[model samples]
Target: MTTKKETRTFNIENLNTRDGGEGESVIGGYAAVFNSPTEIGGGCFTEEIAPGAFSRAIAENSDIRALFNHDWNNVLGRTKSGTLQLSEDERGLKFEVTLPNTSLGRDLKESMQRGDINECSFGFIPTEEHWDYNVEPAKRMILEVDLFEISVVSIPAYEDTEASVIRSKEVNEQVEKRMNLIKKINTTLEAI
Candidate 1:
């Protein structure tokens, strides 16, 4: 079975633009924040990216692209071309994109500078994840991912809520089972 791609968006932090050496505009910001819990699927569950989640992908030199609004046709920069650089720091996945001197690129630069666009997103396929059922809303810790692309977005598309709800139900079942086992043990001890 083929793995499905997922996208997560965060409000842009430290987003800024500067003039490039060749008179082009360059944008940089944190695309993802590490250790921050985000409620997903309308609170069906919460998710956070573990530190180093993108380490393997970046070290392997993945050819990730930078896009506008997650649209392929609106390509802004690319890792293969050295226009897009990805790295991980204490904050999260940081990116710098040298915007091309095209209409789309120019428009994006202007919009970003005007504060009309202030969100960043990344697309990936989860390679490793862990779920904590002890929390009220099950927490999903994304440990590793196959990084694909990052985008500057206006609105973020969330994961499917139905699937999240199903996962939450499964987690609840496990929690209930554990609680039942603990109760049985307590009862047995009382009978002794």
Candidate 2:
């Protein structure tokens, strides 16, 4: 199953670079919120990154890499080169990354300065989620999800709720079709 990805514009104000001398720098911002509804794909959905969302993963010391444009090979701030930190707050999840003085790191910092990169996207496999059809167009509540890589992107690919809700509806439809086919086969056998 394809996991859902979330993207949000990072607050410029929250972005700060601490020069570690000789070119080392750090950049970060709030990557997600708990109760705010963001328009994704063309629909509206609100996601909550629960309090302990990252607890298990953190305990395992998973290698949560940081990339640019979701390019897996283009790993930026990592444990070896620098560091990537994720923390919880009253609003949502916050991420800070220390960048090495490498060419890639300089390029990223320049891009951010030039306003070429201002958004962050994260990938997660949902452990539990619910769609409240009681609300118009339905509102999805992602109670739990396994955190994955967080990337800096030029344009967010997850603007609408289609990726989450529409995909879910499609899955349900397929299941229903299978059930109907099984029922028809059983009916024919009974008649025989």
Best by lDDT: 1
Clashing pairs in 1: none
Model 2 weakest 10-residue run by lDDT: 39-48
lDDT of 2 by residue, 94-172 (tens): 7788876788889898888777778787766776776554444445666766777777776756434565467646645
lDDT of 2 at 30: 69
RMSD for all candidates, in order, please.
4.2, 7.5
Candidate 2 — what's its lDDT?
Answer: 0.65
CA shift of 26, model 2, Å: 0.8
Candidates in order, TM-scores: namely 0.82, 0.71
Which pairs, if any, clash in model 2? 40-159, 40-160, 40-161, 41-159, 41-160, 42-160
Query: What local lDDT does model 1 show for residue 31?
Result: 97
